[model samples]
Target: MPSSSVTISSKCTILPDRNSPIIKTTLKLSVSDLPMLSCHYIQKGVLLSSPPLPPDSLIPLLKRSLAATLSFFPPLAGRLSTDAAGHVHIVCNDAGVEFVHAKAKHLFVASILAPGADVPSCFKEFFVFDNTLSYAGHHMPLAGVQVTELADGVFIGCTVNHSVTDGTSFWNFFNTFAEVCRGDKKISKSPHFSRDTVFNSPAVLPLPAGGPSATFAGDEPLRERIFHFSRESILKLKLKANRKRVNTEILGKESNDGWRAVNGANGKANGAVNRTDEISSFQSLCGQLWRSVTRARKLDGSKTTTFRMAVNCRHRLEPRLEPLYFGNAIQSIPTVASIGELLSRDLHWGADRLHQNVVAHDAATVRRGVQDWESNPRLFPLGNFDGASITMGSSPRFPMYDNDFGWGRPLAVRSGKANKFDGKISAFPGRDGGGSVDLEVVLAPETMAGLENDVEFMQYVS
Candidate 1:
C-alpha cells in the first residue's frame, strides 16, 4: 500500500523579535557533543487541538506564538558553526528556525496515529533537513518547525539539531511554545545555558582528518512498527519480572508474609535481589522487548548481543544539574550478553541486568564517561550494530504529550521516518496518560514478521 503523503503549502523562517538586543555569543562544543554531529535532527509529529483551525488564522497564530516563544529560547533561534580551528560551536546569532506550512491532503489525526501506520515519504518534506549542513560543514539552523493542516486536525512537526539539545530540552522548548500559544506571559521553567556546569577538566582533543563522519550509509531493508502496551499489560510485565524475585525470597526465608514482607524488608534474609533498588517499569519493558527481539531474530547463540540505553545525566551529575539545564545531557550505556544467555534467562534476568546497568551510573560514573569521551571523541562504532544489538531511546519519562497549546493534550506523538534505524526502539507514554508504554520498534523485515507472530511477545501486549 502506498503511504499517505503531504504537500508543502508555504515555507518561511521564524526569527526572534528583531527589536530584542542580539548578543554575539558562541557555545563551545565539547567531546560529549561529537556523537550527534551528523546533523541528525530529532523530529516529532504531534496532533494538535481537536477542532482544527482554518489555515489563514492558524498559521498566523502559530507564527506569532512561536516568535514569542523563541524569545525565551534563543538557542533554538541560533545556527551551528565551526571556528577557524575546526572546533564546532553554536553561534547565538539569531539565524532563525525554518517554519514550513504543509497540507496532508488525506491524512487525519487517526490516520497518522493508528498503530502500525506507515507514514508517507513526503512527510519528511515538512521539516528542515540539509545534508550539506552536517556532511559539507555548512552552517545549519538549530531548529525547525513545520505545522501541517489536516481535514479534522493539525500535525505540528518539530526538528531540533541533536548537537544543541537532547529530548528533554527539546520538549522544554516545545512546552514553552505551547504555553505561549495558550497566552501565558511567563514559562514555568527557564532554561539554563551555563555550559560551565558540565565543563570537562581536560580540554577537548582535536578531530581526526575529514572531521569525524559518524553517519551510517546502509542498504539493508528495514521496517518499523508501533506496539501499544496498556496500563494493565505493563503491570502484567512488571509482575512477571517481580514474581521470580518474590518466589526466591519466599523459598529462601520460608515465610509467606505477602506484600508486607516484600516491601518492609530490606531484602536481606529473603534473598531477594535487593527489591529496595528493584527493576523499574522502564527497565522491565526494555528487557522484555530486547529478549523478544533477540528471540524473534533467532540470532546465533554464540554471538554477543548489546543493549544500549540512553541515560539522562541531569540527576547523575554530582550535586545534580538544574532541572532546566538546556543542552544534550544524555549518554548511552551498553550491556552485553551472549544470545544464548539472553534467550536462556527468564524475563526477570533481563530486567535485573537492565536494572543493574542503570544503578551503575553514579556521579563518578558520569564524570568518567565525560573524560572517556574527551580522550576519544569518535562516535560509537557502527559496525557493532548488527541484528544482534539493540539501542533504546526517547524515554517515556519525557513530557512529550504535555504540550497543550490551548488545545487538549496531543492525540498522538510520533517520530519522523528519518529516526528509523535498525535495532532501535523509541518509547513514548501511552495515550491514557496512565503508566502504560508505547514502543516503536525498527528492525529487519523478517525479524519484524517473527515478532508479530511471537506468542510470548503478544501475550504481554494488548
Candidate 2:
C-alpha cells in the first residue's frame, strides 16, 4: 500500500490529568539512559481486530485514558533539558504527548496478516515522529501515539524516546494506558522513577554543541519479514540443541578415557564442560538464525560473524532493581565466531556460545561495562557495520497481547522504521500463546531472498 492510503484526521496534545498532583521535577539521565540519546525513538504498535465501538467514541476514549495514564508517567509528559554543562535531564513540566487520529479505510486486517505476504511498507505511517532522534525530545513531544482506523481493525502506534524508556518501561506505560481505558482507577504496577538506586554516582558526559552524531543512518536498502516458528518447531530446535550437547559430552568423555588409558594415569581431563547446562529456547532459536543468516549471506569462510543480544540488567545487578524500574537498563553483548567454525560445528556450539555470553554478563560484568562507558561515552552503534553481524532486540517475553484498551486483544504486533538496519531482528510472542515465536527480521534484500529459499531455514519456519 502507498502512503496516500492513510490520511490524518486530527492531531492534538494529550496532557496529564488536571486533578492529579504532578509536581515539576528534573530527572538526570542515568548511565543506561545516556547512551540512547542519539538513538531514534522506539516505535511499536499493536493491530487490534475491529472494535465494537465506532471511531467517534473510540478516539475520545483513547485520548482521555492517555491523559490519565500520563499522570503516572510524568517523565513522558516532560521534555528533555540540557544543562549549561551539557548534561541532559528529563524536565517534567507538563509539556504533554502528541496524539494523532488517522483513517486507513482502504486497508484491512487480512492484508497484513496474510500468510507469506510482505509486511506493508505503509505501516510506518501509522506512527508519529517518523525518523526523529531521541535528542529531538528537547523540542518535540517526548512521546506520541497515532491511532489509525483500518477498514476492519485499529492500529494503535506509539513513539517513545529511547533515552527515556526501554522495552520494559515502554510496555508498562502501554499496559497502564490500557488499564485506564478499561475503567481501572488504579494501575497494578506503578513505575519506579528513581535513578538513585540504579547507580551510586551519576556520571557526567557533556555533549558537543551539535549533539551526538548518528551511529546508524539506516541508508542501506533492506527487506523486513516476519518469520513465525510454531511451538513444535521451537521444541524441535531446543531438543536438537540439547541432544547435540549431550552427545558431544559423551564423545568427550570417551576420548578422555582413551587418553587416560594411553597415558597409564588418572589425570583430570583438559577443560571440564558444564554437564548440567541446557540451551534455552531463545538461545537455540538465535543460534539457528545466526547460522542460517550467515549461510544466506554466503560470506567468505574465513570471515568473522557476530551475534549481539540485548540483555536486561535489572535482575543482574547485585542489589537487584524493582521490576518496575523505568528507563533503559539493557546491555548488548556480542558473541563472535569465524564463519567456518560457526557452520562446521553443530547448532549446540553456536547456542552454547550465545548462552555463555548471556550467562557471563553478571553483576560485576555489568558494573564494569557501566564504568567503561562512563569513562568514554558513545552512542550505540545500532547496525551491522561489519556486514556480518546480527543484532537482536526486544523479546518474546514481553506482554504484547495484554493491551486490550476496552477493545479485544491485539491480532498482531508491528514496529515502525525506527533504528532499523540490516540484520536487526525483533522478537514477539506468537498470538496463540504457545511456545511459538515471531521474529521481525530485517536483512539485505538479496540475503532475505536467499533465506526465503534456503530449505535449512524454511524447514522450521511456520
Candidate 3:
C-alpha cells in the first residue's frame, strides 16, 4: 500500500434475478479443467469513456445486462466443488456474481492511458472475484464484474476462474453481455456447453494434464509495463522474418549444392523454407520479446530458456468443438532453446521456431497431446522455468475491442490484477483494431529496467 494505491469507494453483490434463468443440474468439468485448480483467476479490464449520463446510471445498466447475460451463460453464476476423490465440477446453484461501484479520486483514464505511467492498482478491486475461493469452500461465484468511474473515464474489470473457461469463452461471455447492454434480445452465438464431447470420461482417463503451474513461484519483486507495437512495425517484423526465411532457404540450397558438388549425391537442406514458412504477428512479437528478455536477464548462454505459449484447441480438435463450446479448451506449447541459440540467432530464427510449434498443433497433434495428458496428467511444464523463461498468455487475434457495452470501444485491454507470473506477457489487439498489437509484460525490476533501455527491443515498440 503506497500513496499511489487505490482505495475502495463502494462494494455490493449483484445476484441473478429470481427469473434470470439458470441451469439446474451440476455440470461435470473435464480433466482438462483440473490443472488450473490452484492458479489465479483470469482477470482483465478495459477503460471506456463515461456514458453521457449521470455516473450512477452505469451501475443499473451493468446489473441489468449481467442478469440477462447470465441467463444465457449460467455456469458463470454457478459455484465450483470437488467430489470424494478430489474431482472438480460446477454446481449451477444460481449463486450469482458480485458487482462493485467505485471512484478513484485522482485517477483519470488518460493517466492510465499515458505511456509508461504506473499501472493503477485499483483494477484488481474493480473486478470483484476472489482468487482465494476454494472448491472446498463451495461458496465461490465463478465470475464477477466491477466498474470503477474515474474523473473522465471508466474501468470495467472482469474475473473468470480459468477452470470455468478459456480466453475465447471468456470474451464470448462479454460480447454477449455487450449485446444485452445494447438492447439486443438475443446473443449472436449461444454458448454450447458440450464438455462431454470435448473430453473423454475421467473414469477411463487419468487426472487432467497441462494446467497452469503453482502461482508464479519466483521470489523476485516483479514490475509490469505496457508496450504498444504499431501496425507498421508489426508488418516490418513479418517482412523481415520472411526475408530472413527466404535468405536462409537460399543459403541452405547453396550449401546443399556445394555438398552435392563435393560428394556425388543430392542432399536436402534442413527443411528448406517455403510459402508455408510464413510467420504471424503473434510469433513475430513473441520472438522480439523472448530475445529481449533473454538478453535483459543476461542469462548464461549454456542454460536452457523456454518460451511457453497458450494454444487454443477449439478448432484444432478432430471433430472440432463448436466455436461457443464452454470450459477449458486450451493447450500449452513450450519451445525450448539454449540462451546461446536464442540470443545469437536472428529475429526470424526465433519467429520461425515459435511459428513451427503453432503449425505442428493440427487436429492429430492436439489429439495426441490430449491423450498423453490424460495418460500422464502432469502440470503444464513451466520448465522449472525461472527468470530465464518467457511465458505468453492471451492472443492479439482475440476480439478485444468488440466488447462495446453501449459506450465507445475500450481504449485499451489489460490483464487483470492477479498477474504475478514471472516473465508473463499478455497480448491484445491495438485500439485501432488493425494489425497492431499491445503487449503487457511482467518481469523483475532489474530485468524491467534493462528492458526499458533495450535499444533493439524498443526500436519496434512504440
For lDDT, the strongest prediction is 2
> Against the true structure, what is each candidate's TM-score?
0.88, 0.91, 0.87
lDDT of 2 by residue, 1-462 (tens): 434377999999999986334457788888878888888999999999888897899999999999999989999999998887767889999889999999998887887677786777868889999888898899999999999998888999999999999888999999898889989878998999877755434567667676777787678899999999886666667667666433445544433332111110000110121223666666788889999999999999999999987777777777887778888877778899999999999888998887777666778998998888878877777778889999888877778888988867989999999989989898887888665778899999999998998887798898
**Per-prediction count of colliding residue pairs?**
0, 0, 1
Error of 1 at 189 (Å): 1.5
Per-residue accuracy of model 3 over 1-462 as CA lDDT, tens digit each: 223355566666656655434467777767566666656677887788877767668788888888888888888888876667656678887778877777775677666666875465555556665444223225667887877777778888888877787788888888888888878876898998766664644732233343223555545567888888876666656656656433455544433322111010000001111225567555776788889998999878999898887776766666777867888777777788999988898888987887787767677876777677777765444323465887787766667788888877888787665646668887777887556677888888888888999998898887
- In angstroms, give how far residue 4 of model 1 lies from its true place: 2.5
Q: What does the lDDT read for residue 234 in candidate 3? A: 64
Candidate 1 colliding pairs: none
Model 2 has how many clashing residue pairs?
0
134 in model 1: Cα distance from truth in Å? Answer: 4.9
User: What is the clash count of model 3?
Assistant: 1
User: What order do you get sorting by TM-score, best first?
Assistant: 2, 1, 3
When summed lDDT is taken over every stretch of 10 residues in candidate 2, the lowest stretch is 261-270
How much lDDT does candidate 3 score?
Answer: 0.69
* Worst-scoring 10-residue span by lDDT in model 3: 261-270
